[model samples]
Target: MTDLQQNYAHVYNNSVGFGRYPCLILIDFAQAYFDPDCPLYAEVDSALASALRLRKTAQTANIPIVLTKMTYDVAGVTGGRFFEKAKPLEAFLPGRATGEFAKGLVPQPTEIVVEKQYPSAFFGTSLASTLICLGCDSVLLTGLTTSGCVRASCVDAMSHGFRTIVVADACGDRHDAPHQANLFDMKAKYADVVSEAAALEHLATLVTRG
Candidate 1:
């Protein structure tokens, strides 16, 4: 193991296995993150592809899906401090195509879509209550900007008493450094970080027994 890995090995290395009922939460997989011309673009095409596959698997298993998108009023009235700090958030203002959910992975009519003005979907949103209402014991997270929204959502999910699982290959950042670093930190401190393949395998088991 690398020296850094060895150092953290003794500290934050606990796995929270999947629970009886798990829901998939896709955080901010909006067009802005995929559009090459957008400043918020994160080179997340691979992540989006993996998320599409994961979504199909979850749908077949009859698992609940929750999607989140960053949205704000034209004048940024609701976004407040977060909007001020991150000027790039302007891309999500009303009428901006960047704020819309990516085409292929749009939430179905029965699925939940929580529009928020902040990073964590749980913050100022009904996500926690909605998860409870759905009887979800765990959350499988997939989305963009690993160091930002994805990390925040994972931490909030864990805080809400859900076994948070971050699909490593299904989440991306503009650069590898933050993406990898956040994944390592999340795996150690906040949530279980698993590959998309592993998550799909677990979901398949659910489908088989049901």
Candidate 2:
């Protein structure tokens, strides 16, 4: 009930709610965010753990999971202004160790891996079409840097006409201010911001495909 929360209370309170067919999207949980040597490190291990647990749940439920990572060509021209502004993106250069998925999280051959040079996975990528093909009416989003990639994907998921839910526990940022701020904004506008427990409950109610 802070003044800020009160100001936007009733107007922004509608919930998109979890949809019948959902897809889990793990955004940019790469080595760059986990490595101490990398400037992009966010010290968000708990978020990763939560996401892994959610991933396990999704696996058991036979839910489709999609992972996205940053990838750029040799010249790094693909990333354009974003690459120029955030030099840390160089860590994602081809063949770099930082470009790989973080330890303990590996994509199975059956899973889809979308590589991109931008914050929103749907931008310049096939993610939206893929989700449509899968008949995904909703998206379960989890990833590092709540203020960055997670926020971007959440917005895009909504714009793509999918009911989006951002798992709060499974998402984090380098600082709590931006993390909490963006969560508040996203909840009020673009997506459903939910806890890990609530997300799990939603998953349990889903009917898995054969």
Which candidate's lDDT is highest? 1
Instruction: Please count the clashing residue pairs in each candidate, in the order shown.
Output: 0, 0
Report the C-alpha lDDT of model 2 over 1-210, residue by residue, as the tens digit. Answer: 889978998999999788888899899999998899999988889988999999888877778899898999987999999999999999999989999998988998878999989999899999999989998899999997799899999999999999999999999899999999999999999999999999988787663443
Error of 1 at 170 (Å): 0.4
The window of 10 residues in a row where model 2 has the poorest summed lDDT is: 201-210
> In model 2, how large is the Cα lDDT of residue 82?
96
Please report the TM-score between candidate 2 and the true structure.
0.97
Please provide, for model 1 over 97-159, each residue's C-alpha lDDT reduced to its tens digit, 9 standing for 90 to 100: 998988797679978999988889899999899889989999999998899999998899999
Screening candidate 2 with a backbone cut-off below 3 angstroms (N, C-alpha, C), the clashing residue pairs are none
Residue 197, candidate 2: C-alpha displacement in angstroms: 0.6
TM-score of 1: 0.98
On the 0 to 100 scale, the lDDT of residue 46 in model 2 is 92
